[model samples]
Target: MTEQPRLTTREAAQRLGVKPETVYAYVSRGQLSSERAPGGRGSTFDAREVDALAGRGSRREPGTGGASGASGELSFRTGITLIDKDRYYFRGVDAVELATAYGFEDVAEWVWTGEPAHGSRFTAPQQFLDAARLAVDALPVHSSSMDRLRVAAVATAAADPLRFDLDPSAVLACGRMLIPTLVGALPTVGQHRSGEGRLARQLWQRLTSQLPDEASIRLLDTALALLIDHDLAASTLAARIAASARAHPYAVVSAGLGVLEGPLHGAASGLAHRTLAEVLERGGAAPVVADHLRSGRRVPGLGHRLYPGEDPRATALFALLGAIPQAADALAAARDVVDTTARHTALHANVDLALAVMSVAFGMPAEAGETVFAVARTAGWLAHALEEYAERPLRMRPSGHYTGPRPPRPLPA
Candidate 1:
């Protein structure tokens, strides 16, 4: 086969109408692949791939009011997190910094109220916790963690007479209670520590039987904080839509949970966990990656559309996981997967991969990452719901673009 001509990084960036850094981001995201130059100095990309990507970008006509062209975009003003240049910020503060410096409860409180509530805690009311647990326990033995959470949300809503109250204070109160209830409802693998002071400590008992060290607990706490919100994720959007329809806080959470079942979203970590476990068992990433590709499945936990470069969440968690001596093997397994996949398509590890590392390292089940995601993201769903509630009701309803047979002509048999 004749060798294909290649474009240098600068030329690729120019061809794609993006910066050199963005070209590198494209490589990291697996949107484009690059190879080391002959002398191993700089990277080069296939000319065809760069042109193809540019062609895709050019499809959207400029000045059409939205990135999708004439149909426009559904945009809402949000004072929450902002993602820019591979870094995300929560209310103007760096999310990674906030997560590292403060506990999940404190960070969630800050995201909710725009000010840090030092030493903040989320405690489930006995009534709500009991209701949620009863609902979760009633499920079949084979039910997944997300199934329990969805049912718990409904049960907690039924138990709360004040759930209909949409006042900001009332909603905030519900958020504080609801988060803990969700965590408390899960079946504990070990002896339940119901009275643990920190939410992280409380959740620790439910996730694994092994006693957690200080560093492990800190890792869990940071993971929760980092995941608290990520601007308009699919589940967050679902929650906002429900809130736009005046659904109660618990219903808003239910809406979010409803969307979390998709393989691409909250369940992604579970998939990644299984993959990592397989890699550990198989003893190498090559055959596993090959199997995944041969089956036509994009390796889960590899790339994220929002982050072109490295996922900041993964970077932070990997840093923390590095400090933990027990995580070394799982961490090495994760790196091997990333490195192996990179040879074919340059993709960076996303948060799902990091979550997988934690789950695999701590002897947690495959679904454990999903459980953690559901519990942590519940706070974010509520935060978005609160914002949506303040807007004009039903504002999210958009007119569907009618593409079928023109109105009267569609009345045929």
Candidate 2:
């Protein structure tokens, strides 16, 4: 059969009177879908999709105006991260570049303070770690990693006498200590690494018992750094709201953790992990994808609403994963899933798929991705909270429009 013609990203952008980056933005927002070009160097768009979106005329960019709803227009000026076109940046530097070039501790410090501190390490104080571990150990044996994380946050907060201090420097210190504490509190799966080194090394011990090579450790570090921030995710918004209320840094993280429990958010990676495992077990992507569709479930680990094309983070991680020999089969399974689904939908792989590849390849649990997400994103939540603390307290309050009966009506009988 003759292959249908596809437009390159640049061609699609030109056709739509937008920049290539905007073309990617359209994919991220689900305004468009993208497929991999031959040789897999760039994305190609369905000519029809691009022309159809063009026919709709130029729409206002997201965050430019509020939609009609009970929640009025809300926007905030942030210097931390910007999601543009198909790539994202932290303080105007490419996030993928930053993540790949530095350790998770360095990248996270840069995200929070705008300067990368080389060789920086986060160490959880013994007292705080003790308190957090106690809390985590008290949970039911079956409690998820996220559950342990939440309890640890509260316990850590209680152990700090100055958690009420909202000073910028004080808050930053709290962040430095809190992140390591969260990681240290999780029950280890194999050998226990000392708590005095790189955050990723400590986290590796907790996730799996397999001895990791340099490449595997590098992959894990990059994943954490890449996930450190995304502009105004649901959990970030919640953390900002908590910061606006002058909540302490620990409380702010707790607030973000609360929102991460929803299946649509942090849990998405676990779903993707299960999906990739199924594809591997079933020996093909076709049946797995078919089973999901037949069950009326959208396939996980594909298509992100924010990038109409490839998710840049996924692109970067996948590139790194390709170098690890242990990752070959799982990575192939991920590609199979993407290729299989692409036959029907133009959706490309997202970070969850890459993360699932890591989890499945390393023999980690389904929920390992959630743990990585929550711990890595703690840095971002704190960064947003730092921004919010500088703004006027309570500035996030949006007035609600009354949608019920008139206020003048008497109380119900």
Candidate 3:
């Protein structure tokens, strides 16, 4: 096959967050069928094949069990995952401190490659800059910066011969490099890469263009830190699955981006933002929210799969938004929602509500919420990809489909 193809078993395994044997299992389930390799001891698969197995894609229902093996509940797991019932961390370090104290470019490097602060001493290469610039310039007007990212990933992979290192430090560098180049291309704004500004700050500034001072930058910075990584979430699983196949960090991140694009994980901020906008626009938040509850509507941004009582990040952010006039209504709604939901289910607000609160406080346009999340979560994406590079098996397995009537097509059909 002359196609250079998309991915392989080991690679797909990384994204699936399963053992290589599991990938084979998936193949057996017909969730993922194997493609022929030249000499055939094992079958090769592509990113799309695994994507199809995700239960949202083509092969989805297969006569039963929608999206199995996810193990659903966010419980204790096999890896050393750091959780934040209230505060985010990297192993043990407080993420808020890192976001506040460190430069975003530095933070991006740390997350992508897991290098210590000292490692960013080297600058991004010129060849990378030139190619990244061209990629940015060539992007079509129809695509958002997020879509442009797909093109950028392809370009970056082809331009850099050294893009495949799985070492923590190596992938970290890729993350730092990738975010800046991509954000630099967004429309109605420009990414600041020089003279005292960092990439994270630049992204924040662009996304929150309607905000005041450096406060939005600081808030965005911490948000990114807190969100950078959290073990094997579905999207992170996608990145890891790509990496285990020996694909480079860029490819892993790209696969992860695909998962992030899915509504289940990354689109909450936008959804919450839209809801709050309506509540705020309709006069009083409390009454409107009360009406929603009376109508049996579930409020967005009020719950999490993990933290039941409270999301620490949400708490911190809510506190920050309390004094801002623009955010007052959303903040008030959050308070009532918390009070109402608190008495019923143990569920309290998560980062989504707080983000909506901040979006209003910072005076950012409603659409900015999604972009802000994508910016911050990019850190987490890089971290997950690095994990793929460093871990073993690094493969995703799925059962195969035996759909086409086994032996023959009877020639004339």
Candidate 4:
């Protein structure tokens, strides 16, 4: 039997006239189904599905949960997070309210376990922290935080004797330790302090070169909470694909980290940061946006396909940052970027804009936004992992159509 040829994600995205992330969004919304590409590094879509979605208008409303892809129908069910009417929800709770009212630990519990905000304490064994530090330090000095994070994940998994304990309670226990241990092992820019109050505070120490006040801390906390989950992104889907194979929690997260490194995914924040910084240096948003247009490049950070208008997460975080005096210039620049882009294109300020503003306000690196996104989205990844673990294994394999030149006429036998 001849194997059907599959389309790489980029090919599928091209056929659909959408970006790769939009392909993932279509998968999340049940407009498509993806299978693990060989070696489990990424995903491949059914060529027939792409052809079908291309034939039909795959550009349905973003939040609606039905479309016609392969197999003549598509629908996905998830209890984790929802993006509808330009707002985000966890289960049924308002994400903006959760961001304002609780820390990331509490938000993680809510997103992962669907329990009310119970304020559960996240604790890690001392030995795990020690091992994670060694693992992190083994990376090259130029490595990004996500690079170190991937290393730490594998090392932690190797150290855990019960990593394959697929029981719900056991998996949740592993998640609790994974988040804190990953955060604590990284080198800090500020003076090291022992025993932080919340996950956000500890993460703030790792990210910024200076001490932070309550307002900045709250802003960071809101950023983390807001990023906890977003339906099923590429990273989340990768995590779920690993989980469907019954891979351990750490392996699941490693899969997510690998996918998140894509520039179109989590690392997009870095590009957005660069854009905002250029806007600031050029003295206004108009010039930078003009340069982007003249270069025939899409303006980074100002648009998202998922949101009909401004991304709600960016809107909420920008509103919070407007309260901080230090954030005034960054906030104004972001607004100008948004307004300028809107005048020329259909783009609006997305979460990447908010992340750039946060990094600028707090004196962090360009990639700091990606780091924050990685940590916060870990919760969502674990949640999706659990959901996939409950389903049958290898559930996402996409069948393809053969499109080669008629088997090469027997290949010159």
Q: Can you write out model 2's per-residue Cα lDDT over 320-396, one digit (the tens) per residue?
A: 99999899999999999999999988999999999999999999999999999999999999999888898888865
TM-score of 3: 0.70
Single out the weakest 10-residue window by summed lDDT for candidate 3. Answer: 71-80
Candidate 4 residue 343 Cα shift, in angstroms, is 2.1
As for lDDT, the candidate ahead, 1 or 4, is 1
> Which regions of candidate 3 fall more than 4 Å away from where they truly are?
1-80, 84-88, 96-130, 136-142, 165-169, 188-196, 286-297, 323-326, 340-346, 401-412
Best by lDDT: 2
The weakest ten consecutive residues by lDDT in model 4 span 63-72
lDDT winner, 3 or 4: 4
User: Mind giving the per-residue lDDT tens digits that candidate 3 earns over 60-145?
Assistant: 22212224344312222222246666665665566656655665555655655455674243244567756766786786666665
- Which of the two candidates, 2 or 3, achieves a greater lDDT against the reference? 2
Task: Give the local distance difference test score of model 1.
Answer: 0.86
CA error at residue 289 for candidate 1, angstroms: 0.9
lDDT, each prediction: 0.86, 0.88, 0.63, 0.84
- Order candidates by TM-score, high to low: 2, 4, 1, 3
For model 4, residues 1-413, the per-residue Cα lDDT tens digits are 67668888898878877778778877876667789999998899878787776765454433233333332343345788888878889989999898788888888988888887666678778888888889899888999899988888888888899999988888889989998888888788967576467888889988987788889988998899999999878888788889988999999999999999999999888898888888889899898988888999888887677888889999889888999999998889888888898887777888998999999877899999999999899888999888878877876654444445765375564
TM-score of each: 0.82, 0.82, 0.70, 0.82
